[model samples]
Target: MTTLILMVAGGLLGWSAYHKIPEAFAVAIAAAIMVLPVYLVASGEGRTQAEEDPAKEDPAQVLRRRVQAVNQAFTEAVALMDLLRRDLDAQQAAREALLAEAERQQRLLELNEEEAEKIRQILIGETKASIRAGRRRELRFFLAGILLSAALSIPIGIWVNSIS
Candidate 1:
């Protein structure tokens, strides 16, 4: 409450001085007014929370408090480090899993390509066989036509000779 009052009075004084004085003097006066209350409060001249208690802390107590703070900070840092290590391990495992999956997918693609090549070869062989069978059927039809014409003309030629 005292600090608050001091700060408010200092602000009012600085504002009034800034309007009434020259530029350099006003700035100096304002600066002094603003700093004076803080200096008094920090210097323990006025009644403060520390002055009300008036308990002088021993050196050993201060040392123990500092040590406890240091130990707490160290424990927190160790916990953070352990957490980071676990996170890194999890990331590594996930990376390995992804790599394994990628390799499996690559092998599956290779097998599919191989199967497609085999199917293409089988289709090519069937097409060649079908073409050869068509040509053989055409040749047999031509030979049968020739044999039928020959068989009809031989009987006709013998009948003409007998009639003459």
Candidate 2:
């Protein structure tokens, strides 16, 4: 309200001052022709809703209010992003810790497998020794058994071949 009045008054005063100077009206007319349409378009058609309603005429106040609202919203958005960044950092740290723990567990599992292999080798050696002891006097018996098995296998194979 007051600002618009002041701006119009200033423009009129400046125009009046130019009119007093020699041939300044020519310059003013030329500038006016160039700028009048732009001002009319920028201000919108005839009377704005705010102009019809005097309570909303304070555009300067509205601009200040909008600026404050935007500033607050921007601050809140920044705070949210900061919190998200911190949470991501914490999550990354936890992931690194978990990875390190998994590596340690894997190392322990590999060590356990090596120990089990050593025990398995010892058991295999023991088993070989026991088998040798148990079969010490059965060498001739085993040889006879092998020869008989071979003779039976040859007869069976010949029978299968004839049938086929």
Candidate 3:
């Protein structure tokens, strides 16, 4: 209740006192000063009255504490950023390795295709040789059969002519 009375009195005094200043600016500054504390308390943000007072401890000690807290946060943030950088680098390396492996497999596929072609050519040659060998065997059997028939016929012909 007393705080409210003081704020209103301060605002009215500022509204009347700053004649040389622009009326709008003076009113705005006065209203802002009046409402600032209430806004801070309701939001539960910013330094409280006790923390801002600097009465219980030296001002230098308060400044040092705030600085150390900021420094600690900055250090932790730097470490986190470094870890993220390392993870990104590792991911890039892994992706490159996977791409390299894919290229190697492609080369192997090309080599396999070349090997398959060579095997096909070799099989074709072998099949031709087997066919020629089979033809030669067939020719030999036919010639032997013709010679045996001729020999039997010649002897049989001599006997028939003599008997007639």
Candidate 4:
């Protein structure tokens, strides 16, 4: 309450000080002063709730909470599955881009390989190495991500899907 009152007062002060300026800027500043404190308080309360421990709670309540958590986790897993599919699509696009780049590099090397400017080969070699490393890393990580996601999420979905 004290914070709210102080914020309101600050907004009034800002509006009075800038009232002679553009009305839009004055309103924006005053509105920000009024709104920001409430947003901060609300976000702080949310963090506090998330930080609380569940271990001390009653057994029945704990069990109920566990069920709710599982359900919430399943919902999040479905969302992640969507994200994984999108990521895979992005990975495919990246592979296509790499292929196109490789074709361009091959053409460059073909046209210039015998020339003194074949120093460009060094640059292409570095690019090729980086592309291989990136592809290997992304493929392994992205596939594992999808598999791990499926491992956790598939059964959860099957279990909860019947409820609907």
For each candidate, give its TM-score against the true structure. Answer: 0.58, 0.44, 0.53, 0.27
Better of 3 and 4 by lDDT: 3
- lDDT tens digits by residue: candidate 1, 1-164: 33453444445444544565443453345445445544554444555353345366655765565566556545544444344345446755886999999999999999999999999999999999999999999999999988988999899999998899
RMSD of 1: 19.7
Question: How would you encode candidate 3's per-residue C-alpha lDDT over 28-87 as one tens digit per residue?
Answer: 554454445445444445665766677887888877766665565445444443443454
lDDT of 2 by residue, 50-88 (tens): 655647668776556446655654454444434434544
- Best lDDT among the predictions, by candidate number: 3
Q: Which window of ten consecutive residues has the lowest lDDT sum in model 4?
A: 42-51
Candidate 4 clash figure, as a count: 0
Candidate closer to the true structure by TM-score (higher is better), 1 or 2: 1
Worst 10 contiguous positions by lDDT, candidate 2? 1-10
Predicted structure 4, TM vs. truth:
0.27
lDDT of 4 by residue, 1-164 (tens): 43453445445544554455543454455445544444554344433342356565666875565566555544544444344345446755886999999999998887776664567787898999999999999999999999999999999999899888
lDDT of prediction 1: 0.61
For candidate 2, give the lDDT: 0.61
Cα lDDT computed for each candidate against the true fold: 0.61, 0.61, 0.65, 0.60
TM-score of 3: 0.53
Ranking by TM-score: 1, 3, 2, 4
Q: Which of candidates 1 and 3 reaches a greater TM-score?
A: 1
